[model samples]
Target: MKVVLLQDVAGHGKKGDVVNVSDGYARNVLIAKKWGLEATPKNLNDLKLRTKNEAKLAAEHLAAAREMAEAMKSWKVETAIKTGENGKVFGSVSSREIADEVKKQYDQDLDKKKIILEEPIRSLGMHEIKVKLHPQVTAILRVHVGEA
Candidate 1:
């Protein structure tokens, strides 16, 4: 019997995949557990339409990410850090601080986890930060550190 999987089934196939299984197994396990549906003509057509819509949505997300990356190149976020006597830095500026500064300055919300900071900023100057907007898109964000 042919079945259209609603979710991944180990040793069988992934979601939206059509796989042939024993009639008893399809009726008892897949259909009973709601893991899959009978691969009738209507179900197959519905799956095709859903797949097409998902592809179009994915393409739109990629385009938006690319546009954001380009705009971020020209943006500069300013943040402050405490400085001690004799030009010594008191604390470091982390990814969370950078994300907050960007939101405060540019009114753009950014995820701290997406801000790739190998080490905290410890100096007072301009630095280039790498922001991962999407799997295929990375943006360089300029950050200026000043003494608070």
Candidate 2:
């Protein structure tokens, strides 16, 4: 029996794939568990339409990410914090702080986890930070720290 997989199954095919399996297995395991559907004409056509829509959405996301990456390259975030006499910041600046600052200054939302800071900002100076906007896009942002 031929079936269209709704989700991945170990030792078998992935979602959206059509595979032939024993009729008993298809009826008892796949259809009973709602993990797949019979490869009828209607189900196959539905899968085709769904795949097309998903491709279009993915392309739109990639374009948006590219535009954001270009804009981020020329942008800088300025922040001030309390400092000691030796120019060391009283506390460290975290990725959450940077993400909030970006939103406040540029009106752009960013995930804190995407702000790749190998270490927290602990000194007063200009620093470069890497932001992963997408799997294929990375942006560098300038951060300037000054004493408050």
Best by TM-score: 2
Q: For every model in order, what is the number of clashing pairs?
A: 0, 0
Model 2 CA deviation exceeding 4 Å by range: none
CA deviation > 4 Å runs, candidate 1: none
lDDT computed for candidate 1: 0.94
- Alpha-carbon deviation at 75 in model 1, angstroms: 0.5
Q: Residue by residue across 1-148, what tens digits does model 1's lDDT show?
A: 9999999999999999999999999999999999999999999999999999999999998999899899998898888899989879998999999988888888888999999999999999999999999898899999999999
lDDT of 2 at 62: 87
Q: Pick the candidate with the highest lDDT.
A: 1
Worst 10 residues of 1 by lDDT: 100-109
lDDT (tens digit, per residue) of candidate 2 on 54-114: 9999899889999999998888899988988777669988999999999999999999999
TM-score of structure candidate 1:
0.91
